[model samples]
Target: MNKLLEGKRLLITGAARGLGLDFARRACAAGARVVMADILDELVTEEARALAEQGHDATAVRLDLADPDAIDAVAKFAGETLGAVDGLVNCGAIATGIGGPDMCELELDTWDRVATVNVRGTWLMSRAMVPYLAASGRGRIVNIASDTALWGAPRLMAYVASKGAVISMSRSMARELGPKNICVNTLCPGLTLCEATEYVPQDRHDLYVNGRAIAREQVPEDVTGSVLYLLSDLAGFVTGQTLPVNGGFVFN
Candidate 1:
């Protein structure tokens, strides 16, 4: 709405639904040409088509972060399509159905799976985009993390560890990418109400709601503003930092 990202080229992952898709739409509305990548190819294509019908510059690409080849392909496709990726939102990860076991009960395969998708995927994607971002001369990277790591949420060992890795990686990335004028930051949201979170137990949801100072459920929209700001020039000087967008449920 503010045209904050006018003429910027953006690549957003996990954009078939939830927070990633919202960020893509918001970025488009803010005057950025976006390439939305997701593992759900057909669904993402449809979403991009809908955005196109509304006169927004949007393209959808298939991205399966589990496969290194897929990640490379998507990044190449986005760079070619966007013509110079000014920003990237690494919002894709294994979030659903990966928790519920305590760390002691968590299987090594499960832990490896979460790390491969969430941690490795974020790192590879960011590496693939460095060239284009450096070319933009003011690139931004917003890695979507979770507040569960900060609060030490129980029975979610793998998810929490993966997000913790993301938070740590962002800071390192900011320092490394800073020389290229690329800002890298992390956004840690609390248990947000999204399709991916529908499997969360009612008791857990209640705990988050009651614990937040805001005393309300967090929706996908609640986080889009902070995400967009990080991708915009307004946050050019803001990097190597983590902001908890969880309504005071856990202050960072």
Candidate 2:
């Protein structure tokens, strides 16, 4: 609808479905050339094809956040194909299955898995894309965090810790990348009902809806507006900030 991102090229990771997919769609609609990268190669390809059919500039690439090689390859593909990567959306994450265990009962492997994908992955992707983004002169990076980190939700220890690290990392990154004119920020969304969140228990979902200021189930679209603003020129002066899109679930 609006040409907020016209002529910009944005690369989104973990874009096979859920919030990442919606971000790709919205960015494309906002006149951006989008590169949808995901570990779910087939699904991401189909999504990209669908967007192309809609007459949007969209393409798909395979990326696994845990693999440094894959991250580098995708960054190379984006540079060669998109030319200038004006923005990056790190939306890929791993959460425990429904009814995650308490930290005392959580497996070390599970903790490592979540940290590797959620924390390390975000770092690697950002590091790999710095050159391309910095070259754009007005680069933007939006890391998808969770409100659980702020609210200190119980049981989901690994995920909460991982996102907490992301928020801290975003601030440090903003300070480091500011000289390059690349704005880095983190967005914390409440428990959203999306394909990626199907593992969340219904009771947890109900709790979120009932406790929210809006008293509604948070959805992917609810967070996209903040994302658009962060990536748009309007937020040029905004960086190293964490904005919660959880409908008042946890007020700052």
Q: What is the TM-score of each candidate against the true structure?
A: 0.98, 0.98
- Regions more than 4 Å wrong, model 2: none
Compared with the true structure, all predictions reach lDDT values of 0.92, 0.93
Question: Over the stretch 1-252, how does candidate 1's per-residue lDDT look in tens digits?
Answer: 479889999999999998888899999999999999999999999999999999999999999998999988988998889877899999999863534777778889988998999999999999999998998899999999999989888888888989999999999999999999999999999888887888889899899999999999999989999998998878889999999999999987
User: Which pairs of residues collide in model 2?
Assistant: none
In candidate 1, which residue ranges exceed 4 Å CA deviation?
96-99
Q: What does the lDDT come to for candidate 2?
A: 0.93
Candidate 2, which ten residues in sequence have the lowest lDDT sum? Answer: 94-103
What are the candidates' C-alpha RMSDs? 1.1, 0.9
lDDT of 2 by residue, 1-252 (tens): 488989889999988899999999999999999999999999999999999999999999999999999999999999889997899999988888746788799999999999999999999999999999999999999999999999898998999999999999999999999999999999999988789888778899998998999999988889888898899999999999999999999997
What C-alpha lDDT, on a 0 to 100 scale, does residue 75 get in candidate 1?
85
